[model samples]
Target: MIKFAFCYEHDDTLSFVKNEVQNCLRQREIEISVLCCHNACELAQRAHSGCPDILFCDLEQDDATLRSAIMNVKRANNRLICVSTAASHSAHAEDILLEPLYRMPALNRKHLWRYAALAYEKILDEPASFTYYVRPSYLRVPVHEIRYFASEGRRTHIISADCRDTFYQKLDVVEDLMRHKNCRFMRIHKSYLVNASFIAGFSRDYVLLTTGERLRISKYEYYQMLTNQLKSLKNTKLRYHPSYSEW
Candidate 1:
């Protein structure tokens, strides 16, 4: 279920944004489990009380408290996907926030759908489940919960924060599907495909995921590529681990 909250200073802009968001989700066929509409001050009062899973807000609005409040919630919850509706250059500054779904001049349907599609992929909704079959029956697992996929012999194991599932599949097949799905994953080794959000730290030979598990990097070239990728990212607004070697 995806709970969406909207915040904006202007009433017309808020309504338009809400409408666009609904349309985008409908196009993706993702149902909004909980919908909230709020102005800057109203959201500021309850931003920390219970933050939504996804937030669409005007970061460039003339409200510092609202911006700071939303940002604080984002810092506290790494799973939360916040998309900005601001079109100005200042709102897209490096220090503002790490946004994945927002595009400049995003007041239209097409851009909004792209953002919604991203949110849909990341949401813990049932429709975004990763499916596997065992004979005649099929099991579905929420894509967001999956931490990694590993192959052992001819069977593939799916690891999530909640559970582990094993099924007959190839890691290569899983990797290919995940890439086409635009999932937040990286192939650190031939046998392992890890969720990018679960990654906590990095060293030359291994990646330390947030689940307190370390996965080995198979090759020096792959390690370097991942290191470069991590350096170019601000997804977590994080600094690399102090032990991380430049090489």
Candidate 2:
């Protein structure tokens, strides 16, 4: 069943999102369960029983609180679909619905329903698309290109294979995804979430990545991964794990 959580600033706003979600679910005959939160802090308790497939929050809530809630959803393995007035401002969300309706300052029912249906369609039919999630800066590099992750002050940098395009993503989210045992990602450092298919060699404390970048590996995690999780990645056809080392 698809589950959803809605956190809004007002009752009318909550009603609008709910009505839209229900209308879409009913038409598709999809079973769904829902929980509602009036503010960001209230989200924690509502989502405690189980994670939602989507979460919607208003920008009027405190920024710190909203960010906390977003982080919580990510940590809980939940994908977010936000509803807000400013699409540009809420660029962080995976999906955003901007409503021009001022009557009750609520989301447009048709738009909201269409968005939810589309989300469900994507999740069910295109789960493999997540592999391309590497940031745009890294896209220019060859897929087999190995890289380094290092931290400076407060940010994490993706040192390129050629030591040039050192793009960065915050360390927090990277660290969170690393903790999942079933997740295909492995953490070579506090700042990196390396895809297992990228590793070319391993010896003692270091792993030689396909990008030819050598990175330190936690001894415990290295052993655990090698013995348990690494094979599943290799068996999958997600990426053509090229046999040639110098691709």
Candidate 3:
């Protein structure tokens, strides 16, 4: 069974996306629980109690409002995978999924189903480690060890804290592969795929990687990154660590 919760301001758009989502899930014979929220407060309450596996949010709202609502939901359900219905170009965050709502003509029912399936697969078959075959060697990389990936012509560079390797693969293909395995890799640019954990800061033109590399980002990407950062910071306080004491 898959549970979904939606937060949207416009009722018509909400109905459209929800119907698409429900129809696809039904085809797969998956039982679903749909919770509709009109405001951030309602969304937060549902998140706290229902803890839906997937959260779909409308990005048409004001930045401040969306940020607040996203933060509230994250606080309640840290594990929830959020999908956005706007800002198509930004791969700013790891947890929040971005799907262009305006491009509904291009994104048909099949695309929506694929998106839902991807989210479902992440929840069901998340892997702790990912293996990639570098040209001369095979590396079994831990999901947490990856920092980012950069595409160079026909090769892709795997950048991490300990090592960097180049492999023959396209950025999009690599993105899908990692995503299927539940790795938090966001495509910040056409040539760059970034790990959300390594994003130090970002501006309208660029994203500052933790390693001091500034990667170019589109305007939409910047907005998405900003929203993601806000949600992450808000939920940081709720994250627990066994090694650290509360005091």
Candidate 4:
């Protein structure tokens, strides 16, 4: 569910904007909560407490003060999508906001609905492509091309299909970063992190990659992996063969 906070100066247009946004989200079967704030300070306070997914603010007020308040709110919650509504604004305001500003004469259902749809797309869509920056020349390497990472002293070697690159980074730090960013790297050993997508098979103490590379795996981790694989295969079989229940 997406939560939205609306900060506008005019009291009369508040209901209109709220209803339009609600209706737009309802049509898409998305649940949302909307909070209305009369001023920037109120908006910032609400954002600091609720950490809303999106914030819509009126930009017709004192530009300097409003921008500063918005920046504070953004700093408090980096994930909040801050949007500005203004009929006209100076280039300086645009630079300050940094995000796209909606310019409309009056708040209407159609325009607000379009903006809501756009926000949904921007936040929810995930791209399949992944890249890692190699140091020195700083070349962008596609993550899918890499098979595994092996720790060699202070430097980590990236084994890829085409070429190998060496970078100075801890294995654990790279594993955490990749996992947080939705990469398929899994740490199966103390000194190695293998991409799960490229894993062809596994045994008691080793993992076989699609490239025919055998990587060492701890006995405990290998058992854990085997259990997880069995559970997954059982679930798949149950889903496909409902009547054949014998495991």
lDDT comparing candidate 3 with the true structure? 0.64
Q: Which ranges of candidate 3 are over 4 A from the true structure?
A: 88-110, 128-247
lDDT top scorer = 1
lDDT of 4: 0.63
Output the TM-score of candidate 3: 0.46
Every candidate's CA RMSD: 10.9, 13.8, 12.9, 16.7
**Which residue pairs does candidate 3 place in steric collision?**
none
**Candidate 2, 132: how far from true, in Å?**
20
Name the lDDT value of residue 89 in candidate 4. 49
Give the count of colliding residue pairs in each prediction.
0, 2, 0, 0
Q: Give the range where candidate 4 is weakest over 10 consecutive residues by summed lDDT.
A: 238-247
True lDDT of residue 230, candidate 4 = 41
lDDT of 1 by residue, 1-247 (tens): 5677877667887787778878866654556854455665676566556667788876655566666676676777656777776556555344336444454366667767656655655454333457664443446776667889999987999998788878866787567557534245678898888877678787778888776798999998878777776665544342222223232
Cα lDDT for residue 42, candidate 1: 74
C-alpha RMSD between model 4 and the true structure: 16.7
Question: lDDT tens digits, residues 13-89, model 3?
Answer: 67877898888666655668899887777876666676777777755444565566666655665656666644555
**TM-score for all predictions?**
0.48, 0.44, 0.46, 0.48
* Residue 78 C-alpha lDDT in model 3: 61
Please report how far candidate 2 places residue 171 from its true position, in Å: 34
Q: Identify the superior model by lDDT, candidate 1 or candidate 3.
A: 1
Question: Stretches of candidate 4 above 4 Å error?
Answer: 93-97, 100-106, 127-247
